[model samples]
Target: MAATNQGGPSLLTRTTLIVVAVILVVFAFHALYVYTSERSEIIDDIELDVAESLKRLSKSLGPFIESYAVNEYESLVTTEAALKRHFAVIVEDFEMGEILGQPYYLFGQLRQGDGQYVDVQARDTSITEQLDQAFYAGSAPIIGSSGKVLGEVWVYASDDILVKKLDRALLEELFTVLVLAGILSLLLTAVLRRYFFNSILGIDAALKNSDQEGIPKAPVPSFRYRELAVLSNGINTMLDSIKGSRENLKIERRRLRNTIIGTRSGIWEWNVQTGETVFNERWAEILGYSLEELAPISIETWMTLAHPEDLQRSSELLDKHFRGELDYYECEARMRHKNGHWVWILDRGSVQSWDEHGRPLVMYGTHQDITERKQAEASLSMAAGVFRHAREGIVLTSAGGTILDVNSAFCTLTGYARSEAVNQNYEFMLASDHHNRDFRKQVLSSLENEGVWSGECWIPCRNGSVFPTLMTIAAVSNNDNEIEHYVTLFADISHLKQNEEQLRQIAHYDALTGLPNRLLLSERLRHAVSTTRRHGDVLAVVFMDLDGFKAINDTYGHASGDELLIVLARRMQTTLRECDTVARLGGDEFVVLLPELSSGTDCKPILTRLLAALSAPVDLAGHSVHVSASLGVTLYPQAQDIDADILLRQADIAMYQAKQRGKNQVRFFNGMDGSAFNSRLVPPASSDQSEKQLD
Candidate 1:
């Protein structure tokens, strides 16, 4: 094949020729220049030699002419002859001429007796070539000894000497250049031919040995020439690409087969024009039927199996796919299985070929069984509903503590909007500023180790008010068992805590007065009695009744009575020492337990102070109510051991005695006066008498 018509002529040959031609041309020009220069130099040297010879000739003739000025004509002629002979030896093609006015002559041939100057122009034609080869010619005037102008002498030399020397040198140099250029060209051509021939041979062998598929089985042979090596590499790369494409095609075929077999997908092809359809074995298997049983099917088969409601949507999607409105046809639809059960299917397809008029001729697609997926989606939807409506606050966070999701309850509890909470770190919500780096690290460590943590923590709301919550943090793990997120559930227990506190208060204290009631008072009194016995000191139990409390209640209403009782309770508490205990037994009655008392005298001052405090006028409902407290004082460690109840009863009896003995006075209970202070319930009449005395 005409050298396979590679891109151009062989590069090696072209480059070698170009290089050799450039060298030869350059050398030829140099040789010519050197020849011309040598010739010129030879001519110059000849001219210089001629001029020097003329100078010597003139100097020699100068002496002759000077001597001849006084000599005879014969003597002068003889001197001239001698001078001519001297000049002849120094110059080539030597000639000596004498100038007389405009006429000139040689030394030996003067035309006339005075001066028949030899005319150089009158030379024989036979010697004209010789004369034309003249190197240099010049004339100089001879001066006599007295400085008189003598006849001029002309000298000339020919170029024959210069020509002879130039021919010899130039011939030698020309031979050298021709020989050198020949050898170098031959060497370059040989080297280039070897490299080009070998590279081309290797390439041809590679191409010839290539596979029938036009893909090389082996790499192209390497080359010393960089461009040729690049060509080889390019061919090898193209071959590799072709091989890779074939492998990829095979892999794709296998993958398509595996996809049809492995997944719950059934492949199908439909010829739109022919109204015929083809199904793979998997297609029939998905619907609980054998391929043989479903053979010889048409488009009507699908129409019959597809649910009526889904048929319209699937048809619409198919029409859109045909119109190129979508890249593919995809829909979830229900189709009746062979067992008469409706199976949800995910159908997807694309146009495989088109007709000349841009209508779909053939389409291919798959039907994927999605019944399980649908059920799972329903379950997930239920779970989502629970997450949304659960009462407890729920937060989902990344492992890095960035909040990813929050329920409405969380938004309500923390007083943060959903938009504000998402993507925010939970650190800012911790109530305590002192929960520093170490504390946070411990929390993370606990989560990583235990996967769950539960504790009470204070969380601040967006309003900057903090509430206590029972918080539970659980780590949610991914399929790899790595902690991917955190699920935190917390409930605000502040109201629960408040209820517990209220119950405690109601159990131990009087609601209206906020003072310890009878139960708490008795408890304190027992402890006080024990302390008095241990320390060898007296413990006073003083019981007091407001004198006219009932009348005040009757006149101003019950609320005013409660207000008076609250005022008296506060006054009674403030009148005692820090160690003292004051309590309310019932309506209009208060008890004081003073431990560490030295004697009954110690009780007198406290009882007096109590009466004064009660007598202070109390403002009630815009009315000032004057009331007095009648105190009955009882001492612990008196006569015999006594319990807290008996101590209180003795105080009550003493209080009645004080009331009967002109009310608003303190009475002490001792064995000597225990009979006079009888413990009996006060009658209504006597209580009225006491109230009148207070008024």
Candidate 2:
């Protein structure tokens, strides 16, 4: 039979070699078993002989020990021929001791004899220590005349002779077994090579001569063995199947290529081991480039174009796919475009081939441009974030005004939770008194015609309080221009309204007395004069200067003066009618407007009351202070048409006249001419008459 022409050893040769190796191992173990068994037996025989010699020595030592013949005992133990075969012999005298209140014998006297038949007094050596020095040892106790233990005799032996004899025998037996195994292995190889190896060599040659696609060129010849014949037939059958599969795979590849082209997806094939990559034209086009522009493409090219932040994640997914932890590698990463912008890509791949050791070799995948989709998603995320965190309260409603959604800001502003506010009418957010049905209809009409409405309105809260808000409602329309929904934004303007009121108070009122200042008083006076002309009534403009205010202010400080002024202002305000206006022009100077009067004499009672209120004593900073005002009165609609400033000048002239005359006296301005003023010393009126005049 011809030997196999294949490289390395054929199956028959390798099998025969393995059989020879196994046979050698078996025989070696068998030799070890026999050698160990015989060696153990020889050592056992030697130990048994030592035990018997110790027994005899113990018996002979007994009489000598009893008779106190120490020399005889040593001679008997040392001179024994059987004991000479042993490595050593020991003799120990028994010592008496008590343990746990019980008597016991202990080996005390130590005597040793070596294989040379020389005896030694080993007084420092213990019997147990002497026994440990021997390979094998045994002991027997000597019995005295009273049947008490007098001493112990021990014999120890070596296994040197046993080891030497067993090894000599085992070497001979192993040599014969090795020779036989070698001869038998040669015979088995010859038989197998003639039958099994030759048939397998023929099959191997046929397989080796196959085409590049690995399909056998010719069927394997039949073998003498039925199993080998069947194997040859199976190989032929597999070759035919492979040939058909190759054809089908070509068709499938074409179909898949067409499908990829139709879908406009970028196809990529990667030789993972070589770091080589192949990309379709679409792949370059997705990044706004031509395939020719991205020259010399490789795996490194992909890595260079991919976003640096996404590279680590892509590598992790690829590793997982390679390790079989994932069926496919999928990643969404940004790639650098030709225009210097980032383009989003959805990358998906699977390992297509592996090496014999199961490492990834080749992979195929598709790259899809997802930039638009990513932009849309980003826009949606931004809108959602705005809705969630914006400061202005936002509400979404259907066209019919049913609230559909409310944002966190709305929930916080209105004191209503999102779950509580949704599905209610939009009117629930409107203050009932401020936004009536007609107001709502007007808002709806504006939204319908103009598609938006915005103004300041009061918003009702869950706590039943209304807050001012700047609100805007816009109608969302479909493509047909029909209203679909409404989006309302409410900015709480309560703080703005409060700020306006504070600014008005600071600008138009006295800081100390809380009375209208000169700016407001002048405006009111002009309006009052205008009203008197329309109603055909008279109006009085009274100007007053405090009599003793400067002295009190100097004595008790400005704080005390301010307190007194505030108290006096309050008293005068209360004394006058509700239709009157009281204003503090400056330090201790004030103006009072009494409009809608029937006649000029109608002001006398009010003037009397004003003088009494101003003269009253005020408790200021633990000090009692009394102050009075020099009053001057001027009636509007004088003989000549005059403005508010002329009336004020006329009243000032009358106040100076009254002050010259006496403090706490009222002087009336003569409407006939500005040269002289009418002096009227009005008597103080009772509180009841003051009330009646005020009514």
Candidate 3:
């Protein structure tokens, strides 16, 4: 009771101190505002006065400068002192301040090139220092007859005069301010002591102690002043409300504690100044440690356990919160668990109070486990990296076949940009006519049954080129096992298709002449034989060997011989009907199959043409060489029942007979008699020709 009754500064004394502080603040603010306003007004007036003086001086001097321009300063005073005398009268006419008084206005003219005073009739040499102190100055370029800037005419007003005027005005205002402040402070002090001090003390006494019910034990009476009565009544009302708030706060705190306990999240409080930390049992459990085992924990315990990679960033966020750059601190970081594995924690906190200098005094926050979330994020990042960098083209589409995203490989394969492909139907970029309704249905069915479809397709490119591709289409499902999207992976097979065609050509044709070789020739002969037998028509085989070809090859080289063979082969093909076949059976030997013929006689005309084409002179390396053919003709469906191979052999035998009968002649084999039925010769050229035959 004695301690409670100990005297301290009285209410009246504290109130007086507050009033004095308020008065001083008001005085400072008023002084600053008055000084700034008055200075601004005076500066504006001085600038305007300087501008007016320049206008007047320019008007007075314009006639003189123009005259000097025309007359070349002949009638003007050239000496500086004489010029200053002439300008002094003009300056006096403008009602400028007295010369002996404080310098208010100064005028001068200076040569533009040298910065020296111009030798005008009225240059004022003594006013140079005053002009240097000018706060406001104006100048007009004095141009000469040649349109060059000869000098500048200037007028100025010094700030010294303006400053002196402001000082006198501010002194007068300061006296007025002192009188007003004194009167206001006296009135405020008297009013507070009479009307507010007693009432406020009475309310303070009533609130000093409370009964078990938390109601004020002593009642405060109303004051004589209306404002004092209102203040006393407001304190009583606030005390009653405080009792109800305290009960509600208790219930709310219990509910909050239960919510925190149900969540099983760690709670913590940190004393920033003392470097101490308090943690609940759940905080220790999050890291697989018990409260007793981690009992003597401080902030350093958390720092040491935090993963080194994460501690720096977490600390930065906490500093931001402390410095008020952020409203709160929230960071996800890892800590070393008791089991030696890193555990992720989401730490969140905010300053609860600050010291006098605004440093954080206390911080409160919680921790939550987020290891699973970080793991999932890492997995997602890896999948995204694969999609971006994979070699095979991959396209992701919506379930409805709308193109959603494509990897770089897909863009390269289809020649479509990502912007052009997205939001468009997948068929717009990669699908060909082969992707018909049936194909789509098959894909959908496979997705429904097996969740994937792999097949070959022809995909189209942006340039209207189509190429084969091996594609795999898969269905992507959500957690509920419903199709969310479709993934398509494909590889371009155009090069593979080209390689296959090349291999087929290599297997079936002569590489030198690009004609059907023996293998392809046999196949064609069999097909011709079958067709001729079925139609009851004749098929003839003419086998030809070039005459003097080996002699020409030995003389002109194999390269020339090969060229002659290619030329002759092409000529033979042009001479025969399109249905007929010409094939190279080996060096200098060829077989022609003529099908759908009426008789062996129908082949005579073709044979004659082949001999004529082969006998023509060929130009090889600028040398004219001539080669001839020894032809043997045979017919299919003979009475002896000869097959294609037998027929070939029979024609070959007849060819040997033709070679014996003198080269460059045709011999037809008569199957009924098995002899050379007929022999014909290509008519010889004129005697003047240099063509000669090999022995």
Candidate 4:
């Protein structure tokens, strides 16, 4: 009963106060209405009086104004006692000198002491200014006999009169409102005490005896008034609802607990003010521990287990959540596990309740173990790094052979940007002149049969140039053994190809003159023999030795001798037909093969040209040097079937005979019989040439 009484004032006192407030409001509105109406009426009456006086004055003064009777107009306007009594009057004269750029008016005032009209000194004031100074004003026009308005007659009363009238009316209204409000409050207090006082106290008592959760212990009894009775029934219904809601809340809490357990997430509750904390069993399990092992838990326990680098960030996020700068706190941080290794945790929470001062009081959150996810992310990052920075150009293509992606090395090697390369066909990088449809089909077949294909290829670039690359293309398959994509790895092998070409050049050609060496000449000679036999054509093998090459080498240095050999070799090569071959057998010794000839005589003209070419002067070390050749010619299909070596020996024997006969001459091996060879000298194509014979 004391608690109910201590809550606030009794029902009677509160009702009286409410009634008094309502009465005061009503009186205020009524006073406002009365004040507005009375002021309007007073202003209207003053205006009417001023208008009537102005009209009478204008009528009396119009005649004087029309007749130009200035004195009479001034006299009539000034002596008008009725107009001057409550208003200031003026008579405007059209013929008067201007004041303030307007017609000056004669001013008149009524003296309050004697109630007489008196003229004041004329002042240069505008008529609009005079009207603004008055509370109420009216005007009429003064006309001449010709019906033209000469001037205006304005009458105005002072603001003092309107102010005095409003004051007296407001005082009377306020007094009446006060008296009515006092009587209404007293009557309201008595009525409320009799009808509602006891019923309100009973309701308060019932509410005070409610359970801890605020469900009422008993329903409010019925009241005498219909409104109070309805309120009582509503209170009883609310209590019944509270009981049902409490039971449902218990069931929902159980279900939520079960759901949390099923998800395997850790649950935590914290009292932010007291530094107290509560953790579920799963919270400890996430860190590889039982709840018993983490006894006496508090907020400090979490801080101790958290990685030192993460504590500062966690504190900052917690502060932001407490200050309402964030809707909730979420952080991914590492914590020390029971096994002495760091474990990644996803910590999320929100402030569930606040103190009266709006500070954080209680918080709830969950923790999820994310160590495995973090490890996977690290692995993916490492793989991406390798793909981006590897030395080899790597290409990823879809199963349909469209380029999906390429690394930086690919761009560097192919001279195509990543944007230009993606979505293009895989063949865009291949040299079109080097590779054809058959080549692509071969590559595809290889991949289908062996899952990989690797070889040297020419790759074209954006600048219209191509390079050699060692390319390896392999089919990438998924777990279902279906080919999904093709991964191509290639390295620029232009330098390696260059090295191989250099090695080949060193092996096949003469070091001094760049002519075919003995090894190459032998190979070509064998091939030529076979071709001539197949076509049944005549072939000539010529052995030539320089007549005076050793004397030139002795006279000039070996360098000069080499220079002469190079120049002479090039001249001999140009002098012969494209079907013939000229090779450097050794120092100052050369061999020439003439194939596809109709007869042995077809080569005589060629041999003469060779002699003339070798005899030409050569510039060596600033001196002109002349050299000639002793030539020995042998034709294939001799009397007895002869091999390439026998043909060479016969030509050599003929060359010895030519040199013995004379230095510059051509000798032909005529025939071979068992072990002996016959030699016959052949004349040059010109008439000045000589011939010789030997057996």
- Summarize candidate 2's per-residue lDDT along 243-358 as a digit string, tens digits: 78979999999998799888989999999999989999999999998888888999998999999989989999999999999999999999999999999999999998899999
- Model 1: which residue pairs collide? 104-117, 105-117, 105-118, 106-118, 110-116, 111-116
The Cα local distance difference test for each model comes to: 0.74, 0.82, 0.76, 0.81
Of 1 and 3, the candidate ahead on TM-score is 3
lDDT of 1 by residue, 471-499 (tens): 89999898999989999899999999899
Q: What value does the lDDT take at residue 196 in candidate 2? A: 80
TM-score of each model, paired residue for residue? 0.35, 0.42, 0.41, 0.43
Clashing pairs in model 3?
83-121, 83-122, 83-123, 84-122, 84-123, 87-122
Give lDDT tens digits, candidate 4, residues 1-695.
12334666665666678889999999999999999999999888888778778878877877876667777766676666454466467666664534336555555553333545456436433444554576666778877777878777767677666789899999999999999989887887777777877778778788888666566677778787898899999998988887899899999999997898789899999999999999989899989999889888999989999988898899999999888899999999999899999999999999989889999999999999999999999988987788899999999999998999999999998789999999999877664578897888888899999999999878888788888889999999999999999999999998988999888878888988999898888889899889988999999999889888888899997998898899999999999999899999889999999999999878877886887777777777678888778888899866667688878888888788778877577888767342323333343333222333333
Candidate 4: lDDT of 168? 93
Candidate 1 regions off by >4 Å? 1-390, 397-408, 416-471, 480-482, 493-506, 523-540, 551-560, 573-581, 594-609, 619-623, 634-642, 668-695
What's the residue-level lDDT of 528 in candidate 2?
A: 97
Question: Candidate 4 — worst ten consecutive residues by lDDT sum?
Answer: 686-695
Give the lowest summed-lDDT range of ten residues in model 1: 86-95
- Better by lDDT, candidate 4 or 1: 4
Q: What's model 2's overall lDDT?
A: 0.82
TM-score, predicted candidate 2 vs. hidden true structure: 0.42
